[model samples]
Target: MSEDLPALMSYLDGLPEPHIVFDMDYRIVSANTAYLREFAQGQDVRGQTCYEVSHRFQAPCDQAGESCPRARALVSGQRERVLHLHHTPCGEAYVNIELAPLKDRRGRIRYFIEKMESLAHHHGAPGEQGMVGRAPAFRATLEMALRVAPSAASVLLLGESGTGKELMAKAIHEASPRASAPFVVVECASLSETLFESELFGHEKGAFTGATSARVGLAESANGGTLFLDEVGDIPMSMQVKLLRLLETGTFRRVGSSDLRHTDVRVIAATHRPLREMIAQQQFRVDLYHRLSTFPIRLPPLRERREDIPLLADTLLARVAPLRHLSIAPAGQHRLMSHPFSGNIRELRNVMERAALFCDGDVIELSHIEQALAADAWESGAPTALAVPMVSAPVPALPGHRQAQADAALWEAAQAHRGSRAELAASLGMSERSLYRKLKALKR
Candidate 1:
C-alpha cells in the first residue's frame, strides 16, 4: 500500500455506497466501511482477490464467462458499469457493479475503485420463491431491468407466452422507487372491447346497462405505483386510442362523466406478439407502441437456458407439493431438459406439478415424467409426438408390457454402449442413475 493509500481509504469511508480499491491484478488493496459492513459483514478483505471474495471464482469474471467491468474500464480509461450476481451474506443476489480506473500522475492506470449496489428483489439461484437462474441470457434481461428501475421510465417486456413476463414486471416494480406502492396487473387479452375502457378508466354509476355502482379503474387503483399491462398486443384495437391518450396525458375520465382524473402511476407493458408486424398490418397503433416501449426488455425462452431446468423444477416442485418435499430424480431432470418448452416457464411449472401428481413416492422418477407428459398431450387433444417435440428419440410408452420390452431393449443397448455414461443416458432417454439401477437389477 502507498503512503497516501490511508488518506484515500479515509476519503472512501466518508462516502455512502460499498466501495473497494483493488490493484490491476484484481487483488484488494483496501475496502471502505460500507463494503465491510454490507459485503464482508465487518470482516476484512484486504488480501483476497476481488473475484474470489465476490463470486468465489478461481479466475477473473471474464474467464468464468461473465462481463468484467474492471477490464472494460481499464481499456476505456473511464468508468464502466455492469450487472453481476454476487455471493452475499444473505445469498446470491443481482448487483450493479460500477468500476472506475484510477490513474497515477504519470498517466498510467494504477488502481481501480469498484462500487456495488444490490438488487434486493432478485436472486441468482433458486429459492423458495421469486426469480431464479444465472444463465447469460437471463442475466441480460435482468441487467436491463436494473438499469431502468431507479428511474420512472415506462418499460415494455417482450417474450413468448408463459415466459414469466408478468413476474418480470412485478420484479421491476419491486426494485424501483415505487416498491411501497401497489403493483396492479391488467389482463388485456381477457378484457372485452366493451369492458376495456371501463376497466382501465373507472366507470361511474349508470355508465352502461350493467353499471350498477361506481367502480375504480386499474389506473386509479395503481396511483403512485405501477400498472402492468399483460398481453398488450391483445388489447382491443378499438380501445388503443384511449390507452394512448391516457399514457400521453396521464389524465383520464370515468365513463359517463365529464370530470378528468389524473394519476401518477408508472406503466409497464408486456406482450408475446411482435408489435412491429402488428403496426404494419394496422392491427396496432404506431403512436401507442412508441409510448410503451421506452425501455423494452426481452425475456429469454426456456430452451435458450436449459441448464436452469433442474433449479426451476426443484423450486416449482416445492410450491406444487409443499408438504411432500418431493424431488425430481436425475433421469427425470434429463427428460425435462430434452423437451422444447414452447410455453416456457409456465409450461415447465405445469409439467412439474403433473409429474408430482403421478409419482406416489418421495422422488419423481423417469416413468412419472413420461406419464405426466403423455397425460398433458392427451388432455390438450394432441398426440405426444406432435404436442411436445423431443430432441432425440421419442419417449417409450409406459404400459407394463411395453415397459418390460423397452427395458429389455435398453439393457441390450447398454451392453453394447461404448460412449460416456452421460451420452448413453441421453441416447437411451433415461438418466445414468436409472441405467445403473437397471443394470444392477439384471446382474442380481
Candidate 2:
C-alpha cells in the first residue's frame, strides 16, 4: 500500500493541472508538484485534511453546507464534478473540481483523486475590475457561464435592469475559445428594423439611403468571435425570423445583396424584460427564443446576494476614485448595505461616485452617504420618503453650528422612533451600530 502511494504520486506529477490524492478519511495522502506550487506554495501537506488545507474549516464541506464531490463520489462510486471557491495562495479563487473514486480489488473505496482547474478569468474576491463575488447565488450563475463558455451553444442572460448582464456576457466571451477574435455588440433596442438588419448582416453599396459604400455588418465583424445582442427582447417581431434563420443556418445575406455569407461566431444575448410574456403577447417569436436560449443563465440581483455588498462597494469605490485613496467608514458601509439599491450595480456605482464627490476628506462617513443617496433620489424625481422630521426646538449658538444641528436632528429621530433598534436604524437609512454612534456623538 505504501509503495502504491509513490507510484500514484509519480503518475500525477506528469499532469499539468493541480491534482491531490486523499484517503477516504479526507486526509491528504499526496499532492502533485503542480498542486504544491499552485495551492500549497511548495509546502508539504501530507497529513493535513483537505477541508483545512482548502477552506480552513474544521468540518467537511458537506457538513458545512457545501456540495461535497467526495461524498457524492462515495455513494455513486464514480467521478463527480463541482465548482468550488478554494482558498489559494493568492487568495480565494473559483476552481472546477473533478473528483474520482479509487477502489481496491475488494471493491472497497480506499482513496479519491481530486483534480482542480482554476478559473483565471473570474474572481471570488474583489478585483480591480471584472466579476467580484463569493455569494452562493453568484457562484452558481458564474459556474453556469463557465460551463457553457467552451461550447458553441448560444447563451441567454436573463436579469433585471442594471444587474450587470453585459458584464456577465463579456466574462463568457473572454473565457470562451473565441477570445482572440473581435467581440461586437449590437444594441437591439436602439435600432430600427432596417438598420438592425443592416447593422447585423451588412449592406451592399447603395442598399438603402445611407448605403453609399459597402458596409460590413456586426455579424461579419464578429465572424470568429462573439456577437453580443444587448436588450435582445426589444428586437422587432418583423426581424425575429431573419435572426432565427441566421442562427439556425449559420448563414445570412446582406441587406441588398443576394449572395449569402457565413460567420463562425458565438451568440450571447441579454434582456431585462420578460421574454415569455413577450412570446405570449406575440411581441417576440418563440422559435427565436429557443434558438437564443441554448443555455440560459440568470444573473442574481444585488438584493438576492446582499452578502456581496461590502466587497462590491469597496471595489466600486476604488474604481470611482483611484487617485484619492478614499475609504468608507464602517458606518458608511453599513448604510450602503442597508439600502435597497434598486438599480443594482449601476446604482451602487452612482452612489459611490456621488459619495466620493460629497466627501471633503479621505474617509466617507455616514452623513456623506446619506446626502449622496438623498441627492440621487431627488435628481431622479423620487419623493423624499426617508426624510426625518425636523427638530422643532431651537439650537443655541455654538461652534460647528451645522454639525450640531445635524446631530440634533438625528438624536430627535432616534428618540421619537417607536420600534426595534434595528428597525429604527433601517428606517433612518443606516445600521444599528451607526445609530449608536450618532447617539454617542450627541452625548459628547
Candidate 3:
C-alpha cells in the first residue's frame, strides 16, 4: 500500500459515514471502516458487489445487474443521487446515497465511489409512525379511514386520548384528492377565549393588541387541502357559529377586516369526548354535532381486541429493532398478551421502546420486559385483585315481580305454539286491553 492509502485509512476508519468503492464490474473493491461497520457488521467481506457487500447478500442488486446505482454510476460516469431503501434484520431505514465515478491517470473510470447517509429523524420503519395500529378493531377503524380517505366529506373521529385520532385524520388527508396541497392541523384547545376567533379566522393589521400585520389562520392555510381540528369539541360556542357559517358559505372574514375571503378547506375534526351527550346537555351545538358527524369514526378501545395484541407487539418490536432484530423472550410476549392495554397502541409502543432500552445484545430478555411493564404498571398504579361479597337476598314476590312472572309464562306458552294471547286471555277470563298491557309490560 502507498503512503496515500495509510493517510486515507487513518482519515476514514470507523467514521460512521456510509462510503464504498465499486470496481468497474460494479463489485465492491474496498469499503471504508464506517461502511464495513454499518453494512457488514465488521466481518471479512470483500470482493463482493455494492449491493451484495452493503446488504451482506450475494445476488444481483434489485434482480438486475445494470439497473443498480453503482452499475449506472459506472456506465454514465456522472455523479448520481438517489434515495435507497433497505431492510436489515433489525428494522427498515431509508438511505440517501450519492454515487460518483472514480477515474485513473488514463481518464478511464475504474470504480464508482458510494457515499450514503441515513435520514431518519427517529428511524426504523416507514409508513409505520403516522399510522400505528394492527389490532382487529384498529384494522376496522383504519379500513373505515381508507374508505373515507378518497372523498372530501367532513370526517369526525371519536376516540380516547392518545389513541392516534390526529394520525387517522392525517391518513385521511394523505389518501384524499387534496393530498397534493397543504394539510394543516390545529389543536383547538390551545387558544384562549380572547384569541380563539383570531386563531381560526385570521387577523388584519391592528385587529387587536398584537395584530401588527395581516395574518392568515389555519383555515386559510389549509385552502384546497385538509384542515384537521384536533379536540374540536373544545371550540367555544362563538367560534362554532363562525365555523358553521364558513362551512355553509365557504367564505370567512378575518378579524377587523370587512372583506370576506372564500376558501376550499375541508374540515376533519376529532375529539375524544361524546359530542352527542354534550349536545343533549346543551354544551355542544345540536346543528354542529350533526354537521360534524357527517362521517363519524369511533375507535374501539384496546382491551376489546386481545387477539390482536401479539401481532401489534411484534410489529412494534420490528419497528424499533436495531441493526439486528431484538430477540424478545417468549415469556415477555406472554406477559404482553396477558396485560390489558388501557392506553391502546400508544401505550404498547412506549412499553416496547422502554424495554429495548435495557435490552442486552440482540436478545431482549424477560427481565427487561418485566421491568418495563412493571414500571408502566406502577406509574398507572398496580392492579389489585379484589373479591366482591356475594350477597344472598330473599326473593320477594312483589307486584312488579308477579306481573313479570305472568308475562314470562305467557311468552313461554306463545313460544311453545300454544293458544293465542286472546285465547289465553279468554281462558284466564281477562279483557284484551289488560292482556295487551300485561304483555307490553314484560317486554321491558
Q: What RMSD, rounded to one decimal, does every model reach?
A: 6.2, 5.5, 18.2
The stretch of ten residues in a row with the least summed lDDT in candidate 1 is 384-393
Rank by lDDT (best first): 1, 2, 3
The digit string of per-residue lDDT tens for model 2 on 184-211 reads 8999999998789999999999988878
> Which lDDT values do the candidates have, in the order given?
0.84, 0.83, 0.66
Order the candidate numbers by TM-score, best to worst. 2, 1, 3
Candidate number that wins on TM-score, 2 or 3 = 2
Which of the predicted structures, 1 or 3, would earn the higher lDDT when compared with the native? 1
lDDT string, candidate 1, 197-316, tens digits: 899998999999999999999999999999999999999888999898889989999998999999888999999999999999999999999999999999999999898888888888
lDDT of 3 by residue, 1-444 (tens): 223344554665656786776666666656788776666677655676666654444666657322356656656778876544444434545455678876767777766677876533212233335444334466567657766767878999998876778777877787678989999988888977668778878999998888889999878988999988899889887678888888777899999999999889888999988888888888789888778778999977666666566666666777777455776656556556555666777888888887777564565554455455555534545321001111122222324543444345445433332335554444333455876886686676
lDDT of predicted model 2: 0.83
Clashes of 2: 0
Tell me the TM-score of model 1. 0.84
What is the Å distance of residue 226 in model 1 from its true position? 1.4
lDDT of 1 at 9: 88
Estimate the TM-score of every prediction.
0.84, 0.86, 0.56
